[model samples]
Target chain A: MGKRLEGDGRGGVEQDLLRHDCSIGEILKQRGVSRRDFLRFCSAMTAAMALPASFAPRVAQALDQVKRPTLVWLEMQSCTGDTEALLRSANPTVAEIVLEILSVDYHETIMAAAGHQAEGALDKAIADFKGNYICVIEGSISTKDGGIYGTTGGKTHLERARQVCGGALATIAVGTCAAYGGIAAASPNPTGAVGVMEAVPGTTVINLPGCPVNADNLTATIVHYLVFGKIPALDSHGRPLFAYGKRIHDNCERRPHFDAGQYVEQWGDDGHRKGFCLYKMGCKGPATFHNCPSQRYNEKTSWPIAAGHPCAGCSEPHFWDTMSPMYKRLPNVPGFGIEQTADKIGLGLVVGAGAAFAVHGALNALRRDKEPNEDTREG
Target chain B: MSNQPKFKRYIWELPVRWCHWVNMACIVILSVSGFFIGNPVSFGSSASDFTMGWIRFIHFTAAYLFAVSVMSRVIWSFIGNKYSSWREFFPLMTDAGRKKTVRMLRYYLLIDKEVPETVGHNPLATAAYVVLFGIYSVMILTGFALYAQHAPQGSMHKALGFMYVLFSDQGMRLAHHISMWFIFGFVINHIYSAWLMDIKEHGGEISSMFSGYKFTVKKEE
Candidate 1:
């Protein structure tokens, strides 16, 4: 496998170690993660999925007993941000154990294989698992000029995605890039990047869209698939409803301040110090739908809003275009230069109409005065 | 003046007038509150004051009324008199209607001194109302789509969630915001046109909306 993956001896050893036959319980036992800790993680996942506390044991049972499912991670035109988010999770042991539970047959970034070996692994994984494997895509697929922009192992991303994702039982688009093309498909998008669903149409794509998607949601999605044998319910955007069903504003910690009309007028103001609502600072919480307020990030430490910064609406579709002017309340009207907002355009049109009507009315009045003889007495 | 007697004809039904007035009030409240919701005014000093809460309450209440008014108006278009018929909204659909619309356009453009006479809404005003109704439909859809976000599991959410297929949340908000100005533009032109028609036609044009009657010249019977 190209002289084995160099660095951190663990990668080489992990690659050699195969756990295709092991159940998640066996993996947890081997990892020395206690039953209590595993159960706690299960409960947390159940809660995250909005399942009742009673379902925690059922979730634990399902996850513990389920054999490792084959997962093929395709990283295309990506920064590897999602992988980083998962690897740097707050509770590394639990994350590690979960990863161990899944037979990750092919992952370009972390796999020890290289060149032909990596390509071989991907093909073999697809053949072995066929329709049984889960495909997790990490970035947008470049389709410009037939995806010449992004290639791995001599195949275009579009070709790779269509081949791999087309056969998976269900595909999980793991980040905003893979889900909605994110920044890669922003305005003046030169690469013609599109999400996995667009690149590989008709595939069952469950979009988990965030800048670098919170790893807990990914873990929960995997766990839910393990327990339910099907993808969780999806919203209109094909996002898992548990995570993307509610606006950040509805569940925001600073909602009290918003209702009160208290706001952070500017950066580092007294109101800002007082933990006022960031809505006035152009927080996109009101429009964006994600479970960040409840789920938080980095092990429920703090999300952007909790840290006193506004939500940038990173999880939304085409967020780069739709939720920009990051410090403004409304998105800028796109066509007539950059700075004009909808309100400005709307107000301008209204005023223009009013002015036009005024001029028309005055003209009508002057004409009426000149035509007094034509007005006549109708009696 | 030609020797033709004038008679009062009942042009607008009660439901038509009610829907018109209700829609007008809702538009005003929805515009004011919707603007505030987008760019809220910071006034309350304490969390308990609930200033934005009250504003949102008013906005939602008006939105409900507006939706109901629009729905009832659509229903009334089927049941109301020929003057308020659904056919009036599509003036260009018929040859006579197209001719009247052209004549109205000619008068408005000062190509003709005579205003086109009609028992109900003139073809031009009917066409304008059709456009206004289109805007109203968009406003309702976008408005409820935004509202549906608050209760994701509610029936309203299920019903309106498809709007995301048409517009992103922020895009929907932008559309909803811009449409308010279109309505405002329509209102300005509408008022001016009504006033101009009232003065020029001397047919109780402004009073007809309130009284449901318009003075029409009696044709030989």
Candidate 2:
């Protein structure tokens, strides 16, 4: 807040100057990307957002005119797997193109600047852009004992997050850790880690939760913001509805096999080799919501199901806790411990109740036979 | 035949009987289909039939019927007659009703041999029915909430989509499954108690649900 760059006020003039000064069209042209390819990528973005074909040109025009928004990516209690996934762009596709559109101010893993220079770059970007820059938070914020678990440039990740996110437009919480505490906040969370929304109260946190969030979703989310000047419409979980709207079971490639009642009971049977439904073997696809089926990872190469492995429900909240044991169906009903399923517990109760009922019925019959005046009661 | 000493009293109305039977059928179908849906067991490799699809269809269809019958029962409780009215569902509304509940509990426990006299359900039965209705609401809400995930946005499915917000979809599924077991327990106990009461009281209690009439012994004052 030191140097308030003509931010909230003079919005129209700032937009015009920013667009005119450093246009994405010029940047892409310098990078040898043609207009037709750019337009095609815009259409792809529109399709990814579940928007109609007519909105493609609008997306293209908005993207072509907008300046590269400054982004400050902060990693807290993370594995840096999200950044690794982003860097592992399988092919020269739309995701890579979108990634290049953002002018990353400070990223711990990728940036050359470090020490005071890295902190200086973050401060400069926040001060210069004010309420216009984007804050991309990866991993969970360790709030235990004043966030001593994670630090950078002599400042705790929590302090740096609050400082940078104070004047940002919106924060994109990338990966499961940043969204819902992922594996870091699983049962007996040692560091008291929490998602960005919990760490930064007022910031509009758009969660793109996954073990290492699908690169396509990350690209689409950023493009949606660059085009519309706001984050895409989110579900109750703060995830973009287009990507996480439908359950993995609903849009599964193995759904036909599931409908036909063909399931792979074990890991290497003929059914498993034939790519049958993995529901029986504890595939959490039915309970999980993600676009991994349509939006396959690694440049449209092969998703988990196509690779003959069951989905782990990585994109969901508390997946580590709820969808554990990875290869089976049904969640562990908390008090039942990790080994027991709800069916097992329910069956036990039902059997016990049935046995008790039979005993009670026999006792009633004996009591009835013992009574001499039973006939008098009935007319 | 004309000098019969028995007296017959009409207890359940037609609407109440219809709702009861419809709900009973739906519960049977829903529970069977629901069990299969959760844990799909192989029924041979029948190439022609879509086993899981048909199972889910039957499950959803029965679920809708169950919801409708439950809703109808709620409406009927307000208008159906004194015997089938909402007041009968809450027997603890009066002081005498509370005493009747204790007496019925004692009767079931074998502490009292004399069955509590009631035209419809005893106070204990009324209380159990009320609790069962609460379980019905949970199943219906969670069922629709799960259905809402596949439904088009802004529809009635979306309107009841708050279950996902309150708990994860699996949590909703857990509630639905647990409630099914509760209904199963209720059904077993209900049948056992009805038969036991009929034999002990000699009031034609079990037949009352089907025929809407119970024969009671006439007493000379």
Candidate 3:
């Protein structure tokens, strides 16, 4: 278990990372990515980074120069959805080989080591790498009931995270659970779940806040870090500015449909199959931010909106509690009048209630004797 | 015995009336503009965008007017009619005013079918108006908060920073949208109260708000 350098984390994950020891040009020879395709990808990444065309050369040089970054992917209290989303992606296998050697130090599902051996190997990588590795954390940070919600080797996840992220170059929070406490921390989160930023405030936390973030977003963000020697400029939410800089409504594929007032009002309607905008279906795209519309999930196969499911806005914090009734436009305002939401209801209640109060106040105002006006009183 | 007529006099000054009417105009514009912004129905409408650019133009113009009105109101609080003064805006904080408020509520509830009259504003209406102004001030605070977002790191931003925190960016939006409905509610209640009071008193109390006169009967002694 003294597998310090070439990790035993991903079971045979180091093999996947090492399998592509050949240069990208050579790898492309096998995968069939042409010179044009590679350049196009480089240019897209540069633009996504918000750099001018001139930066394309630098991006090309950096990508060509750096070997894929060494990665220590950690899975905490989460379903393996993030892993599934990445590995089970459509045919183009670029995502599978993003890391030159996926030195997965302690991925529970994929790692080959058992119990003490896996735990021992994890410590070895931390000691060996010191400060030269990317730590990608998936899922939420559970701290409930003394961190008993999810434990690895008798150590709470909070304990494991602090150990892994102690001196990492940069930390990538891979999913909503890791980025903003997805459903696990929805409401009355018993696990004391939190995103990495809340978990480690001092570290440079690059949040890819999605239920399952776009694989390309994670790749570009990592590659941008590799090429530029720093994380990309981030928005207030600590999300990479390149991906979360614009609202989904600002560039949605269904944007034209929203502008045209073409909405699929009900399920099983013609508009639904015809693929109208999901705004009316409670698409959180207007309020929520992410790069799904542009990035296109599953190697450009489709996304939630494209596949006819309204986005639940898993990226936004407390989304389940905040943006629930996922198919409604207005979130229920707390301490507000209830009979006041649907159109005409608030108006009716207002008129009726106002009239009743008015009649009563007027009757009291009547049958009164004239008294000294306060304004007219002698000083 | 001798008989003579006495002047009832004006409780509100010219500037006060001007501020009030101007505020009314601004609120009307603000409500219409804000509503169009809220529900921008563009089906079968002429220009293709559901954003209602024209209404937004009017809305912002009214916002400027509203800003002026607020500035004037702040000044009026310091220097205006005694009845309109900051102290007079609230009922006496004395124990008597507290008792009067309870009495007024009970009176309205017909717990005692007797009417109580006092000078200026009754305790109940005075307290309600104070709350009314408080909400208006909040609307102003939130409106400026939205304006600051276009450029968020300067004097204007810092000046209104408290509002940004009071209602964060999202809350600012919710307040702005819902404030219009609050104004609509105020308008409905305001009109009914004024008309009903006018008919009950037979003093043309509602028209007097516009004509600035009230005829009062004086008995000779």
Interface RMSD of each: 4.7, 5.4, 6.6
lDDT per prediction?
A: 0.84, 0.79, 0.67
The candidate scoring highest on DockQ is: 1
Instruction: Chain A TM-score per model, please list them.
Output: 0.91, 0.88, 0.84
> Which lDDT tens digits does candidate 1 get at residues B1-221?
32345788888999999999999999888888887888888887997889999999999999999999999999999999888899989989999788778877977886666555667787888888889999999999998888888998789888876787888778888888888888999999899999988887667899999999888665323
Give the alpha carbon lDDT tens digit for every residue of A70-178 in model 2: 7878888889998888877665545446655776666877765567766766777788889988889999988899999888787887897898788888898999999
Candidate 3 at residue A300, lDDT? 73
lDDT of 3 by residue, A77-137 (tens): 7887787776665743354344332345556666667788777667766676768778889
**Pairs of residues at least 3 apart in sequence or in different chains that clash in candidate 3:** A9-A104, A11-A111, A11-A112, A17-A100, A17-A101
> Whole-model lDDT, candidate 2?
0.79
TM-score, B chain alone, candidates in order: 0.95, 0.91, 0.80
| Native contacts recovered, each model | 0.64, 0.37, 0.09
Q: Hey, what RMSD does candidate 1 come out at?
A: 3.6
lDDT score for residue B195 of model 2:
80
* Lowest lDDT block of 10, candidate 2 chain A: A1-10
Best by TM-score: 1
User: On residues A39-80, what C-alpha lDDT tens digit does candidate 1 reach at each position?
Assistant: 888888998898899999999899888988888899988899
Q: On lDDT, who's better, 1 or 2?
A: 1
TM-score of each: 0.92, 0.91, 0.79
| Higher-scoring candidate on DockQ, 1 or 3 | 1
CA shift of B130, model 1, Å: 1.0
